[model samples]
Target chain A: MIEILLSFSQATGIYSFMNSPWGWPVAESIHFFGLCLLVGTVGLFDLRMMGFAKEISLADLHRLVPAGVAGYSLNVVTGIMFLSTAPDQYIYNPAVQSKFFFMLIAGINMVFFYATTANEVKSGDAISRVLFRAKAIAAISLACWCAVIICGRLITYYRPPYHWCLWC
Target chain B: MPGSKLGLLKLETLARLEETALSTWMRESGFAFFSALTVHSLAMAFVVGINFAIALRLVGFAPRLEIAALSRFYSLHWYAAVFIFISGMALLLAYPAKALTNPVFYLKLAALTLGLLISRHFQATFFDRPKVTNDRRTINLAYVSVLLWVVTLTAGRFLAYTHNTLLASRYF
Candidate 1:
């Protein structure tokens, strides 16, 4: 897996750019900027559903989801850049593993929301059960994303023993 | 005081801060230092995220969305802002010289302060008027606010790199 990622990165020139003097920090900055965008948009949408800011229409706020999608795309690109640049440093890191785990949960939560509660929740007032489900989904999504952010920070700040896996 | 003399005086004070129990503990204890750093990042993301949303709105992303109602998110924004302050002060206390002596740190401070002041301006205007519409001035302010936030985030990232002195007490 590491070889494949490195080969792909080298083939795509991402490795060279990331190895350059300013490349890593630049990518890190953009990676974070993308996250802020996601939090601002999709995260805000979640807050709306979870009964925080009750003023904005759900359908209207959904207009900003495209921007959140765009932000997620940016993070994926930069994330790939980082992963492919140094697979060895990241792949074994438990913090990175935890970060990926949170992202996976968030992804599943999003698809589930869109598949199940999205329509009912977005169409103004919904049945009580649907509202409850939507709130649960929103809370899960927010928690997952927050956990992802914490894991990302931990990747830089701490490198635990036997970091190849979390339980070890 | 002479310029070099003043510089030395500042360094002397910073060195004293570095030797303090709290600062020493924060630096030595990974849990304390990294927890503060993580909270700082979390708070920064929320604050910047909310600001970006507001800026996008004012720049005409959601044309019909009520600006006043949207400003309700300001409640969350300010709460996150307070976390930024507490975490930020903790970070600064840990390494007083690392941030204080850096010019980039000052740039970040200026940008963040101006960006937040713009947040206040938006919240005040939108809440006061029932049907406030975006004008040329408002749109321009939105653009400026966006730019200021960009500078603030970028400068924050660069602060790690641009610091000339990591610990002032080393020289003292």
Candidate 2:
């Protein structure tokens, strides 16, 4: 996995750019900006479903979700830059592993929401306080994203992580 | 004193601040420093995120979203803003000279202040009004708010790379 990612970066010039002094911090800035965008949009939608900002129409708020998708795309691009550029450092780190785990949960939760609850919640079509399921999904989604952020911070502190990491 | 001397004097004071029991604990304790940094990031995301959402609306993304109702999120934004300051202060306490001696830190402070002021203006103007209109000036302010926030984030990231004095206590 590391070899393939390195080769891809080398071919794409991502290796050269990321190796530069400014590259890492620049990427960090963009990564954070993207996160804020996601939190502001998709997270806001989640909050509304959880019943904050009750006056705002769910369908109207749904429009901002595209911006959230855009933010998520930015994060993925920058994330690959970080991961591919230094696979050894991140791949073996337990914090990075936990971050990925939360991201996966958030992703799955999003899919499940759209599949089961989005339509009724958005259109107000037969919506109920039994939209309890929707609220639960929203809470889980928010918690997962928050957990992901915390884990991202922990990665810096846990360098060359200890033996608890099975591969480490 | 000349400008350079005054600057040096300020840094000397900050260096002593870093040596205090509280500052020492904040810097040396992994849990303390780590908590401050993490809370700062979390609060920042919410504050910046909410600001971005409002700016987008002003520039016409969600045309039907009543700007009045949208400003309600400002309550959350304000709450997060307070955390940003509290966490920010803890971070500065941890590395007094590191932040105070760096010009980039001041730039971030300035940009963030301006961004919040813009948010305050928007909230005060639109929140109570049943009808809201984004005039040309208001739209321009929104654009400027976005730029200010980008500057704040960039300047913040650059602080780690650009600081020339990590511990002014060397001279102290």
Candidate 3:
């Protein structure tokens, strides 16, 4: 199984990426920029939710949410590029696996926010006391994103020794 | 013994530190060390990025902020931090001995630890304070938090060159 996985990893389509001079560094730089934008947009919004700026309209603050979304989207596109170039390295890697899962959880957590809090938020009641669910969603979202970063960091450590694990 | 030859040799004697079993395993597994290195560095943006947001808010970069409104982005920031940390650990595992012996690595860890502690304290104290105004204490903490992250990241970057245990005989 390891042999097959290694073979696949060394295959032409994937290996071509490593051969490309601009490929690796470009992916890296873009990933970093995306991270910064994501952090700038979403991180600021999260700080707002945590009561940093009471005078700022929540409605107005929502404007930054798309930037966070854009960051996530950019990461996804660049991330896919890296993954396509090195599928086995990431697929079998435990860190990558956990990152994928946490990312999924983070995504669902976002949906939950939109589903449960969108209405109240839209009504301008998001800052009120009855918004317990929204708060809960916020807390969960923070935790999930943290988990995603941790898992993503560990991906290099968790690569499966061989591709045969794919069958399992 | 104070003036012994070995004492003089201590300055010149360089002991090799070999790569650990885990690191060797990672290298053999075909992961590109260069790519992993870049990713690990990139992950910091997430960790420090969200942190900077929170810190800046505390320091008055954005006034009149709402805790409720901030919670949304905070969650995503947490996600980004966690992803970065996990990847960092993996990179560390890829070179455990080097990292373990590197003073810079320990420095980064200590800074991160302190930064988190202070951040949590700020959240508990100020996030729910009666007013949204930025107090001196909050501003101080914000500055300190940013300093810690910056130091931590710089130290992390320097670890590659400062490692005293890379390719040492212990693991080789």
Candidate 4:
């Protein structure tokens, strides 16, 4: 699977663009901005779900989630650019793998939130059972996202000792 | 002392700060610098993230949301800001000359100051109100705040690429 992904990335022309003087730095800036958007909107919504700001209606808070989703989309685009530019750096790095793992967990947590707890909270009155579940999902989502950030930061520190392949 | 003289003296003091034991420890200690960097990045996410949410709300991204209610995040923002400030200081102390000499460093500081001021202004004008009026001025302030925060993040990132000197006392 890694081999296939590596080959697919190397086949793209983004490598030269990414290797350009301004490419990486510009992408990094956008990546950080996207992170702020994701964490700010989605994370705030999660906090509300966990009963942090009870006065605000959950429906109102949910309005911010689309912005968070937009941030996630931005990151996905930049992240693919990064991966295509240097597939080996990410493919072989344990830190990147860990980041993917955390992202997967966060994705699952999101699904759980939407599928199960979202409706209960949307009613604007958090019953005890729904509140407990919401709190648990919220905590998990926060932790997973935090781990994803930490692991992403650690990727450079844990670069794989491998030569770059032109076409994999 | 004249203004320029005072500036030189302050730079001299900052240069000396690099030679302090704490600064030396921060630089030489294994993992300490890295840990501080991690903390700084994480805290930054929270600070920038919450601020972005607030900015979006002000600009009418979520029209149904009450601006006053969003002020609940003010405490979290401050907490993250405090964390970022301390960790950032550790980073600066570790290489005072590197940051102090870099033009980008000053830009980052300036941007951060402007961002903070905008944040305070938001708190006073919008958050403190019982009902936030989504006027043009409020939206403009929100737009400016978001732009300043993005500038702060970009300048901060560029600091790594733009610094020329590692230690001011030895070089200067």
Clashing pairs in 4: none
Error of 4 at B46 (Å): 1.2
Q: How far off is residue B11 in model 2, in Å?
A: 2.7
Model 4 chain A worst lDDT window (10 residues): A159-168
Order of quality (DockQ): 2, 1, 4, 3
Error of 3 at A93 (Å): 2.4
Cα miss at A133, model 2 (Å)? 0.5
Candidate 3: lDDT of A92?
72
Ranking the candidates on lDDT from highest down gives: 2, 1, 4, 3
| Candidate 2 chain B, poorest ten consecutive residues by summed lDDT | B163-172
Q: Among these predicted structures, which one has the highest DockQ? A: 2
Name the weakest run of 10 consecutive residues (lDDT summed) in model 1 chain B.
B163-172
Model 4: residue A3 alpha-carbon error in angstroms: 7.3
- Using DockQ as the measure, name the better of candidate 1 and candidate 3: 1
For each candidate, the DockQ is 0.58, 0.64, 0.12, 0.50
C-alpha DockQ for predicted model 2: 0.64
lDDT of 4 by residue, B50-168 (tens): 88998888877888888888887887888889999999999888888788878889888988888888888777776657565878987888898899889998888778777776653
lDDT of 1 by residue, A4-33 (tens): 999999999999999988888888888989
Per-model TM-score of chain B: 0.93, 0.93, 0.72, 0.85
What lDDT score goes with residue A2 in model 1? 83
The window of 10 residues in a row where model 4 chain B has the poorest summed lDDT is B163-172
Task: Mark the 10 consecutive residues where model 1 chain A has the least summed lDDT.
Answer: A159-168
Better of 2 and 3 by TM-score: 2
Q: Which residue runs does candidate 1 get wrong by more than 4 Å?
A: A160-168, B1-3, B168-172
Per-model TM-score on C-alpha atoms: 0.94, 0.95, 0.52, 0.89
